[model samples]
Target: MDEVQVGAGGATDFARWTGEFEAKVVARAAAGDPDWARGARLDPAVARSVQRFQVGESGDGANLIGKADRAGDPVYSAAVRLFIAEERNHARLLGLLLRAGGQPTLSGHWTDAVFVRLRRALGLRVELMVLMLAEVVALRYYRALRDGTTDALTTQVAGLILADEQRHVPFHCQRLRVAFAASSRPARLFAVAVWWVLMVGVTAVVAVDHGPALRQFGVRRADFGRGVFGLFAVIVPSAIPLRDPVRIA
Candidate 1:
């Protein structure tokens, strides 16, 4: 794999991200998982919905790691590994939450399968772009889970994953800003346009697929889609600048 070049003086420092992820590792080790003995009471609709998200979060991330390593930024590669670990932890937490509620974790889901295929079909930049759609969607979905649910254990678990995801959007943006720093304006615009299209399509699928659970959470399907696009509106400019980014850090 060839290195994705960023113009000199424009490379975003990823050491900050590495340090943040490391600090999180320490903090998580200290704080530990939410008490599962308390158990959870999930609506059948919500449980089915969470089962699909758990599958989305579960992956080896070898392809992403390999691409990061070949991108020639050890600090960024290290940060990406930490990022993947946190995602896996989300899957674990969700699985545990489901078990505590007497629901079984799913082996797979068609939606997750489609996302994995789409992400794997591209290079590092494109993969991250595809991934950002999921991240943005998760930001909303988890927030709804955290705030809209009456289940204490579910709220706690969603809060934890939501916090990590809040950081994840900007972390990916920092790298993406650098990735696009050398591209032409028209190219960046084209990429952003495509990203928006993908976001709309994916959000629509999720909104329909999870509408029942979202209703249980008191969020309408239209509102869920709106919230996802709202988050994405903020992310696109951060990741893809129409004018050259002044600084990515």
Candidate 2:
């Protein structure tokens, strides 16, 4: 990945994002990976949960890249490629974590299948909206996995993925801010409403699906849902300004 720095006001600076991602790639290479040889001890439920998330992260991202190319922003397109690479790296990390725990990665998961279908069913803006949902949900999940687990290797892997996911959210948000910049107030408000509904639905599904694992980490299902909502509260305003925003020239 490259090194990227969001400029003042978090402007749409894809070049910075590209550099950041590249820098991350360099840093990751230099740091190397966690010692998988130590092995991990994962609860059965947690292993199952991680398997599903691994499936979610394991995608070619061809559709997203195609959409980005069609968007006609070459810099953004390049940055998106690095973003996808990082996501695939997340899958790799999770798979290795499972292996360390003597578990196999799932061949597929219904939740991931549905999510991929939903994201690919629309244009880049819509795709990004759907992707943002995953990114935000992952924020809470990886945090719990990192902080709640006793296994040092599992914690390390989760922490790494969490770091990338934190970057991913605002990166997508910056693009989406531009995407909605030309919309009317009424339109923006409507988008905010719709986004809220979708977020609630998705969070509920995830909480229900990962309930056992979340409980293992001492996170109540309701608490998980609330946490996701809390995160999205910030995102909705950032991504879709309901008030008339000064156009970014």
Provide the overall lDDT of each model, using Cα atoms, as 2-decimal numbers.
Answer: 0.89, 0.89
Looking at candidate 1, the ten consecutive residues that score lowest on lDDT are: 1-10
Candidate 2 lDDT tens digits, 65-153: 99999999999999999999999999999999999999999999999899999988999999999998899899999999998888999
The true-versus-predicted C-alpha distance at residue 157 of model 2, in Å, is 0.4
Q: Any runs in candidate 1 off by more than 4 Å, and if so which?
A: 1-11, 245-249
Which residue pairs collide, candidate 1? none
Taking the tens digit of each residue's C-alpha lDDT, what string does model 1 give over 33-126? Answer: 8999989999999999999999999988999999999999999999999999999999999999999999999999999998899888899999
lDDT for 32 in candidate 2 is 99
Quote model 1's TM-score: 0.94
